[model samples]
Each structure stands twice: as C-alpha cells, then as structure tokens.
Target: MLVALREWSYSRILLVAAFLSIAGCAAQLAPPYDKTVADGLNSANTEAMTLMAATSQGTDKNSFSAREDTYNALIGTLDALALSAGARPMPKNRFTDAINKVLEKRGGKPIDDDDSTPPSAHSIKKIAETLTKMRDTDKKQGVTAIEAQAFKGQLVIYFDQAITYENFLQR
Candidate 1:
C-alpha cells in the first residue's frame, strides 16, 4: 500500500511538471499587431466623423446606433493595443506631441495627458521621415521583418488620420 501511494504521488508530480514546462514554452505564433484593431479604428473614426457631422446638422436616428457601436469598438481597440504595448510605445515625443496638439485644436481638448511643449515643424519633419522609413518595408533587406511589419499599414493609417485633423484645424 505504501509503495503504491508513493508511485501515485510521483506520477502526479511528473505530470504537473510536464504541464508547466509545456505551458512555459507556449508562444503566440500570430503577428504582434492585430488587424482587427486597425480595421476597427478605421471604421470607428469614419463613423465618428460622420456622427459629428450629423450632430452638427440634425441627428440621424438610423446612423446613431451604428456610430455608437463603432465608437465602442474604437475605444476597446485602443485599450487593448495600449495594454499590449505594455504602456511603453506611446510617449511625449515630437510626433506624438504634434498629434496631441492637432487633436486639442480640433476637439477643444487634449486626447492624452501631454504636459510638454508642442513639437516644432523641424522635429515633426524628422519624425515623419522616420515613420516613412518604418512604413516602407524592404523584404530583400529584411527591414521591419516579422511581426513588426504587421503594424506598418496601421501606423500609416493613423498618421494620415492625424494629418487630416491637423489640416482641418489649419482650415
């Protein structure tokens, strides 16, 4: 009886150790950036801008619900992306500061908690060049290889969106 009990305990311990080892080795095989997030934000921004236009005029009851759903999706995607980046991707840099300024000027409030001075045109140009480089992937050179390439399109889209807002403010 004693020998049987010991053997059972050993088997249980071995099974648990194997499970833990396999769990530790498990990794995500998918791309780092989610395509769903990109699509969600794109649709959400379009819906939001349309909704804003509608509000300025008369509210469209038919579109209201759809717009609300898009807004929710956008918010959820933003939260998920932030969480995924471990809250380190976004910072008060020149490009981001410019984006915040544009948002504030258009929306009458800052979207982020940026306390630094707004970035200069020179800084913005430099950052834009960097972003352009990032977006342009050269497979032969292995530029932005692997999971990072998945983010290029989304990053470009957001950059364009911010530029549009800034231009709107200019107008």
Candidate 2:
C-alpha cells in the first residue's frame, strides 16, 4: 500500500510539472493582450465596412478622386496597426531561423524578415495592400459593385484574421 501511494505521488508530481511547463510556454508564444489593439481592430473594421458600402455603387463608386484621401487614410491606419503589432516581442522559432540562413546563402531575400513578423502584423500588411489595389482600381475604370463586394470580402477576411489573432493572444 505504501509503494502504491509513492507511485501515485510521483505520477501526480509529473502531471503537475507538465502542466506548469505548458502554462509557461503559452506566454512565450505571443505578446500579452492589449486592449487598445483590440479596440483599434474593431474600429478599423467598422470604418472599412462603411467606406466600402458607400463606394460600392452609384456616384461614389467611381469617385476615386474624391475618395482618394479616405483610401489613403485607411491604408495609413492599417500600416500603423502593422507597425504596432510588429513592435511586440515574439520569440523566434528555431526551424525558421535555420530556414532563413539557407535562404540567405542562396542569395534570396528571406521572406518576412525570417518570419519574425507576428501573424497580426502580416495580416494587417496584406489588408493595406488589398486596399491599395482597390484604390488603384477605383482610379482606373472604377470598381464595379461586384468588384467592390469582392474587395470588401477580402478585407473582411483579413480583418477577421487579425482580430481573431489578437483575441487569441488574450487567452
């Protein structure tokens, strides 16, 4: 009976140790959650939706010139968000470090600074690029309703990804 108790205690110790290790590792994977980041993401999504709806049809659809400032401003907001995300510390994975070295030896520009960029930043950057493309399209033949909706869909996906990631970090 004493031997069984000893074995049970050992097992309990191991289980607790494993749980502690995992709990500690979770914090290392990403930065702590920031309320401001969450707020910013929600605000950006709201503004983007409003803008896209306004320009999806009618006179506003082709009014790229008039809305140029709005487009530029949105792009700037995304860029700033990306910068904010990138500024946070994220531990580098060893596998990516090795891959980056190999890419550098091959004289290829290592993608995304050796994967140092946080996922949220990457998503935000993509959002900015998509918006820029939308702006250019508007400047040209002007975005059709179909095109506008398509762009809006893409933007929604990107925004959701970033927002989801930010929320996940809170956990």
Candidate 3:
C-alpha cells in the first residue's frame, strides 16, 4: 500500500511538469509583433500598390507583356508579407481579408469570355469611386487602421489619374 501511494504521487508531479513545459513552449512560439514586423508589412503594402498601379497602366496601354510582369510582382509582394507575418506567427487572415476586400471593391470579378477586355474608362472611374467609398467605410469601422490610411492616399492618386485617362480615352 505504501509503495503504490509513492508511485502515484511521482506520476502526478511528472504530468504537471510536462504540462507546464508544453505551455511555456507555446508561449515562446507566438510572441507579439515588434517594430520589424510592422515595418515589413508597410513595405510590402507599398510594393503591392506599386505593382497594382503598374498593372493598371499596362491594361490601359493594352500591353499584355506588362500585365503579366505587374501581376507577378504584386503576387510576390503579397507572398513575402504572408511569410513574414507567419514567421512572427501573427494572424495573417485579417491582413489577407483586408486585401481581398480592397480588390473586390476595385471591380474584382472572375475573368470570362464576356469580360476579356478591362473595364471601360467610365467603368474604371466608377470602380475608383467605389474604392474610395469602401476606404471611407473601413475608416469608419475602425478596422485596418494602417491599411485605411495608406489606401486613402492611394485612392486619391488613382482617382486623379483615372479621370485624366478617361478624358484621354474620350478624345
């Protein structure tokens, strides 16, 4: 009876120690985001926007080659952001969702035979307007603070250029 009790107490101690060890490991694996992650995300967002602008320009010029290059650049930037965030073990889904929302607001639709050409100049203006509205909404909701700020600036630039291009298209 005495031997059994001693063995049982030792087993409980071992189990508790093992549980504590596992918890400590989990805590170490998911540290909070530091300045490095924030800076990397900012850089990635800038690069993505640059690529998106290039893609829009290529589409305007009807240059198929430029389109692919721009698209590839955009994807590469996005991938880098994802990897960096993952290394920090930060939640990437929110960031990705923010990006998808922006794209969706910008006339994102599935490509089909009926939609072979890019949107018309009028349509592009409408898309830009819609994007601005979405940015405003995001700002109101208090989600994606950094993205909202950056997007507001980008949208202004895009809207002005879009208007100019549309005017040229009309001539």
Candidate 4:
C-alpha cells in the first residue's frame, strides 16, 4: 500500500509539473519586447547603411555582396520589430498603403512586381550612389541630424507603445 501511495504521489507531481511547463512555454512563445531587440534592430539599420555607403565608393564585389546581405537582414529585422510592436498584419491593400507612405516620403518610385528577382550588383551600386547623394544633401541642408534624431525617437516611442499593447493583450 505504501508503494502504491508513493507512486500515486509521484504521478500527481509529474502531472502538475507538466501543466506548469506548458503554461510557461505559452507565455514565452509570446514574450514582450525587451530592450535588447529594439536596440539590435536600430544598430542593424545603421550598419546596413554604413555598408551600403562603403560599397558605393568602390568596385569591390565582396563589399557589394555584404551590403546587399546587410540590407536584406535589416528588412527582416524591421519586419520582426513591426510584429513585436503589435502592428497587425494588414490586408494586402492596407499593406500596400503603408509601404506607399514610406516610398512617397523618400521620393521613391514604386515597383510593380510579384516576387521579382533580387536587385543585381549594378542596381545595388546605383542605389548606393543615390543614398550617398541623399546623405550629402542632408548634411548640406542640416537635415541629417534632425531627421536621424527624429526617426530614432519615433521608433522608440512606437516600440514602447507596442509593448504596452502586448502587455494589455497578455492580461
């Protein structure tokens, strides 16, 4: 009888532990946005821009490849940041509208493609040139400092708000 009782107690303990483990995993699956992730994304964006600038100045194939890879990584990081910020995946039209807003702000023309090939080295070089020119203009007009600070502040606020929303949802 004592052995049976011991077995029963052990089984109950195991059951309770399993339940708690499952709950813990569920919580972690949707954990809140910590400072590390936010900072990492910001750093990645800066690094990508720097690489792009370097690639534009020379004909080094390796630099261009690195710049392209960094740019793609930045895009992924931005998307993840948006997700963590609680920006719901909008419908196709809404997503297009959001993208258009950025494009318009940058005076960029929209491309009409559904899974187009990635930009070639030549195209990347051209983009880098354009970015260099824009950077120069920003410096000349004293806009770079203002814009960079404003963007950083805006991103921080946006992420903070997102964390608030996530907290609310968790509750």
TM-score per prediction, in order, is: 0.24, 0.70, 0.29, 0.27
Q: After superposing candidate 4, which stretches have Cα over 4 Å from the reference?
A: 1-72, 80-143
Ranking by TM-score: 2, 3, 4, 1
User: What is the per-residue lDDT of model 4 for residues 1-171, given as tens digits with 9 covering 90 to 100?
Assistant: 999999999999999999897664422222333454446545644665564344333333323443455545555555555444333222344444666578777877755543221112122233334344434444344234445444344434544443344344343
Candidates' C-alpha lDDT: 0.43, 0.81, 0.44, 0.45
Work out how many backbone clashes candidate 4 has: 0
Best by lDDT: 2
Clash pairs, candidate 2, are none
lDDT of 3 by residue, 46-153 (tens): 654564444332223233443445445444544444344334332334444566467667876832332222222233334334444433443344224454455546
In order of lDDT, best first, we have 2, 4, 3, 1
With a 3 Å backbone cut-off (N, CA, C), the pairs that clash in candidate 1 are none
Number of the predicted model whose TM-score against the real structure is largest: 2
- The TM-score of predicted model 2 comes to 0.70
Write down the RMSD of all candidates, one decimal each: 20.3, 6.5, 17.9, 15.5
| Tens digit per residue, CA lDDT, model 1, 34-94 | 3443454455446434433433333334444544554455445444533432322324445
